[model samples]
Target: MSYIIMEIKKISSVETYPVRHEVLRKGKPIETCIFKGDDDEQTIHLGLFLDDQLVGIISVFKEQNNLFSETNQFQIRGMAVLEEFQGKGLGTKLVKEAEKHCINLNANVIWFNARENAVPFYEKLDYKIIGDSFLIPEVGIHFVMYKKIH
Candidate 1:
């Protein structure tokens, strides 16, 4: 395996729409609704770039509360890896970088509405489930999971 250098950075205005659409369209069939937005929030969006190619991405939203009722935590949104990049540990690296960024922002935890199929992935990272499964329109069944950032 080639050494994959993952660089994380904020998503700029020009990359916003493209990233959103890519996450929605390529991520899953139901992602279109949850990702519906005009990119007008204080969310920190980060893309995983391998040299010059955009291969994976994740976003962290600093918040006091949301439907998940998580306070003093950062929410993970729009996590997706390019099909070709799957299984390269890029997704895990992206989440780790996001968690580090959240800790830097004084956040005590990082959480996400994780799809059922992804529960084990998050579980392996030690993210604890906090609630029963629920579905968001255009998004499939998911659970609110959280992991403390130390």
Candidate 2:
């Protein structure tokens, strides 16, 4: 069971759109605005391939805020592992890869607005909840979580 991870740009610039949409569609809550390709910043998608077949994906967007810190950081937006592959730790692996990518780029922290149901998963990876809960409409109720990398 070998797997490989690649940047969205490295595969095809247009490939990230459908994967992002599919993940959102499967998990979106009512009253939330649907995610569109334009919502994504340039060059932020990642895909996981196993045996040459694309099977999981995640998107990370970097943000720079003086209040938070001086350096740029990343926030995960889209994430999904194909149904047949969910329990195999692929989601965690995808996250670790994203963190490694951000760290390589000089990021100090990795953060995300994680959905309520996914909180335990992130907690296991050492991410801590940082703020009040909020609803992202189509995305669901989320809590901000962060993990320092630097």
Candidate 3:
């Protein structure tokens, strides 16, 4: 098997939609991948590339969550890795890179509404589920997961 080098870098929010739609939204409309804070000035989107092709994506927004009293908290959203690249440590790399990015901005915490299936992945990265699972309308079950970055 040939080894492929992966490049992880900061990208524009619009650049994240294709992978997000393909892997996260699936049968849903493409517009479904365009999240609320995608264009926020304080939001940062990270894309993982393999040989110049984008394969994974995640977005971090400088936002406060009521559950966490910290004012320097950020929320992770629109995190998706293409099906073929799902278990190759690409997602872990993306989150780690995002944490570094958050630290540069002086962020103390990073949180997200993680899908049920992804809880284990986040747990491996030391993110804790803050509350019981809840349904997100058409999005199935989810948990509020968070980690301290500072």
Listed per candidate, the RMSD to the true structure in angstroms reads 3.6, 4.2, 1.4
- lDDT (Cα, tens digit) per residue for candidate 3, span 76-150: 998999998889899999999988888888888899999999999999999999978999987899999999766
lDDT of 1 by residue, 1-150 (tens): 888566878775345445546654655543352453326576777878888677777877765445444457778877888777788788899899998888778887788788888899899899999868999776579888888765
Which residue pairs collide in model 3, if any?
none
Clashing residue pairs, candidate 2? 32-137, 32-138
User: Comparing 1 and 2 by lDDT, which wins?
Assistant: 1
- Please give the lDDT score for candidate 1: 0.74
Which stretches of model 1 miss by more than 4 angstroms? Answer: 1-5, 13-20, 26-41, 66-71
Return whichever of 2 and 3 wins on lDDT. Answer: 3
**What are the models' TM-scores?**
0.79, 0.77, 0.95
Error of 3 at 89 (Å): 0.4
Task: Give the TM-score ranking, best first.
Answer: 3, 1, 2
Give candidate 3 misplaced runs (Cα > 4 Å).
Answer: 1-3
By TM-score, how accurate is candidate 3? 0.95
Question: lDDT per residue, candidate 2, 1-150, as tens digits?
Answer: 754544332344245555554555654433232334424554366788875667778777766433366477777767777778778888898898888778888888788778898899999999999868999765579988888887
TM-score pick, better of 1 and 2: 1
Indicate whether candidate 1 or candidate 3 has the larger TM-score: 3
Clashes per model (N, Cα, C within 3 A): 1, 2, 0
